[model samples]
Target: MSGQGTGRKARLAGSLLPPPGPARMLAVAALVTSLGFGGYTAGSVLFFTRGAGLSTGQVGVGLSLAGLLAVGGNILFGRLADRWGPREITMVVGGLQVVALLLSTVVDSFAMFLPVVCLLGVSEQAGKVCRNALIGGAVDGDDLVRTLAYLRSVLNGGIAVGAMLASIAVRYDTRSAYQILLFAIAGVSLFGYSLYLFVPRTRPAPRLRKKKDFPKAPPSISYVFTGLLCGIVNLGDTVLTVGLPLWVIGQTAAPKPMAAWLHAVNTLLIVLLQVRASRGAKTITGATRLLRLAGWTMAAACPVFWLAHDFPAVWASIALLIGVLLLTASELWNSAAIWGLSFSLAPAEARGAYLGKFSIGTTLREVFGPVLVIGLITGTGGSGWFLLAGLMAFASACAGPVVRKAQRESGVSDGTLARGRSGSG
Candidate 1:
């Protein structure tokens, strides 16, 4: 009996382990990087305000400027990664980030802070594009999305641990504590991303053939359209985080602390279930179907959120929890679909360039999504939720046809689509 139990336990443990590949190295790097960055980010506002003596407005403006500059920089870096090599580019960018983080530890004025922050932002975004391109080169087909799912889960776990530790500094609210945390972040970041040296190098993607190919040689109109649509649908993330917090605190009777708990629940759910949710996203059709489901799921959550406003405290909390569950489900479905489609839709020859352009939509979302969410849902007495529901449903409905049309235009056959590899340049 004891021998049989040991065998079953060993099998279960083996089943729980991530498959061995380049993704394993990437996952470890992501975790370490997230741990350091997460700790710093959680306490950064306080650091800037207290340690550096900068006003909130200055910090906000500086960060916004950095974000704007990173938009174009992402494209440039992506092209460079394709021309050079993703592994090399990633290491170079990672080194820059280490430098920037170290500089951030001593930035005492808005002028000094602005440039450092911009460099950090641009480098970070470029690193992401390069890393994704690396994954595209390193892994293939169904395993691509699977690897991303696993990385995300590991990153989240690291961030959670880091944030918990940083909370002590946050609680102290002292300049010394903040500086210590910042220095630690820089040191950790330096050590963490150095693991990239272990990741096997990938070949540079093929160069563009014609100068007059598409107006944008790497990113076609079809890709831009799909990316933008995906970004819009991904607004569900903003709704759950920003919109829900505002709604619960200001509009509903739920306790103020409930927002934090809801966020915790979201992070936990994603870590536990993201890989499972990515199961059907290995092919274009499968990804498109998942996206549609995500839209409907998000739409369903809107009503639940709207309904929460009418309930008593206990009931309101319950409604919010259920609503969050629905939103998280939508997030899982949408993320899986996006990861699969983003890679499979692009030509392998210019994967970095295509993925870089695709990432702009996500950047735009970070820029505009919050403002739209707050403006619509804050003062509209929940009527904005109805409009959002309609938008999600319509977007979901459009995904299938849009993806199919793009596939046809790209001249990729159904078999190619099913394999989730190879697209026309």
Candidate 2:
């Protein structure tokens, strides 16, 4: 690293203890990117169901397939960002998202819609990978955790706002509403991609010259386990994104407007509470602490959906809101911890690959979570809520041990220490 890079790293490290300028910029970009992404998610369900008239099961299939495509995109773009730099890849991916969203406005058939959704999913994954890689390069250890938390909060916050707007659009005109959303998403993507250009490119760390000089380290078993655990916990989100709205529109006599409110409430709470939650998470050094808290919270939150089925009952709305809030809280904790651990655990030379593989957990959730929820809901009828809740709790409980073992076996407690020791060895 150059003298300038060294100074920058020191500054970033210092900011984890306080606050810093680069961290703020990274947060802003994350917020913007999340807003664009959120709007598309909020809008897509209504578009497929109301406008295109797809069945709930069909929608799940489409989303799952799209998610699988995104798995590939996430890995590819994540590595590219690390190799080529986040700035270039972000710009390219952001532009692709804009084009994909715009194209969705013109295409009405499932055949056309399927391909577009797949491309959009890929675009979403690429932008996220690039954004996180950039943030990791710019921030230090503790700040990285806080940064990830804030980024998630902003993303959820944007989704809340976008979902609210989509709700309004659906009330007036579904087609025109989506058209407007596409424009807004394009604008946000452009602004974020532009800001990315201003960030300084980080030089790659130097490679070790000799194999024997390298320390004998245990393979990253925990990393893979963490990925699996994340995939399971993410089922809660998949349920909300696909199952909740479908359930609402199908079971309730209430107007479709209620779906927007449920989504909005979830997004709003995440945006507002994530920072506070992340700050508190700083006190927790062990992955076990974070994962246990997240699992318990999600397990408790999942059964609240049964209340939503009662439509028109005051308790239904309250229960649904409370459940969403709890789930988001779990997300905030798990996300921060995961970000910190992944960045800390990865080999310096292969940080991008590690992050990409970590993201596969999320992508897999996107793929199978929906399908699982749909099947459970269809097969057992009203028992899907219980099933989802159980899955979340199980997943959460498993994540802690998996991460701790990974940490101990790798003989690295944190990424910064790992990087230093690796250099010396």
Candidate 3:
């Protein structure tokens, strides 16, 4: 009876925590890393402008420079990961985060902070590639997709927790308040690194092919279309994070704080539904189909957003919530689909490099989206959103053909390896 009780307790504990494995360890690392970055980001503007005594202009310049460095680093470190290994690089990335956050807390000048900002940026991008690549190289098939979804859910959970803590600093609105947030963030970074230390060491993946004999050929046309389709859908980042909130304020009759609430809904939905959504994402065809459908769901949400202005206050709130719900739901599907497709598309040996290139789509969208949103999406109002939605749906339709063509170009006609290995280009 005592032995039975011990077994039951262990089973319960295992269920509550992650099952004992690298996946759980990776999830914990992702949680703490996201927490630190999220908190740092929430308090950052005030930290630089008030606490550190830098002008808004100084802050923007520093950030833009850092972003450029990070963009370059993703591609560079990707190749490096393919060469050296993701595990060692991942450790270095975590260490850099710890050093950068703690150091940034003390810097009082733009000149001093600029380098730190750059370091943080590189750390962020490098960590992203290394972590994803580590998972790609270490895990496979259904377990791969499942783990990816959980890691993402954990990332959002961390951000939510970090943001909640930062809310306290927001209320106090003092340099000390901000400093304390940074201190907490630094501590969280260290915690993440501790989790990183426990991850079982994984071997470096071999290169896809040696380049010594032949000149490197450009990727085929099919690959370009596939990439474009992926990138267009990836623009949901701008839509979910920036466009939706701004649209809520300018276009909808809903209150401003509702925007935050709607985002809460998004985060909550991701936590609840992301893993379920990923169940179908274990293969390329299924993932592609899911992403395609997700686009239409997002499309349907647009007009609901537009029509919210026509209703009275309570009903308008209802319509707006409905729209946000659709959008967030679509986000869940799209995230899972994209994960499977991205994971499967890369060659086994070049998984790191492939994932690195895949990340550039989001980076590119982030760089271009602000202007696109402010100048076009918001400028044209509901009509513009309708147009944007139409384009997304079109992309969804095209995604199937494009992915099929990409599969053909990769020399897979039967779709067996395409589903099983996911090695496209």
- TM per prediction: 0.91, 0.79, 0.86
State which candidate, 1 or 2, has the greater TM-score: 1
Candidate 2 lDDT trough over 10 residues, lowest sum: 416-425
| lDDT for each residue of candidate 1 in 1-425, tens digit (9 for 90 to 100) | 99999999976543333577677888888889889877976888788888889998898787777777877888888877767677788888888988887888788999898999889888888888888887777776547888888887887778888888899898988888888888888888888878888887776423444433422434357766677778878898888778989999998889999998998999899888888999888778888888899989998998888888989999999999999999999999988888877777777766777888888877777667877888888868889989889988998888888888777776665434223332211
The top-ranked prediction according to lDDT is 1
CA lDDT of each candidate?
Answer: 0.80, 0.68, 0.73
Flag regions of model 1 displaced more than 4 Å: 1-17, 205-216, 415-425
Q: Rank the candidates by TM-score, best first.
A: 1, 3, 2
How close to the true structure is residue 101 of candidate 3, measured as C-alpha lDDT?
82
* lDDT by residue (tens digit), candidate 3, 294-399: 8888888878877876677678788878987888777777888767666666665555666666666555565666556555557885677778788779989998
Task: Give the poorly placed runs of model 2, Cα more than 4 Å off.
Answer: 1-20, 45-61, 108-111, 167-177, 206-221, 245-259, 280-285, 307-312, 316-318, 414-425
Displacement of the residue 407 alpha carbon in candidate 3, Å: 1.9
- Alpha carbon lDDT at 108, candidate 1: 92
Q: Which stretches of candidate 3 lie over 4 Å from their true place?
A: 1-18, 53-65, 107-114, 205-228, 412-425
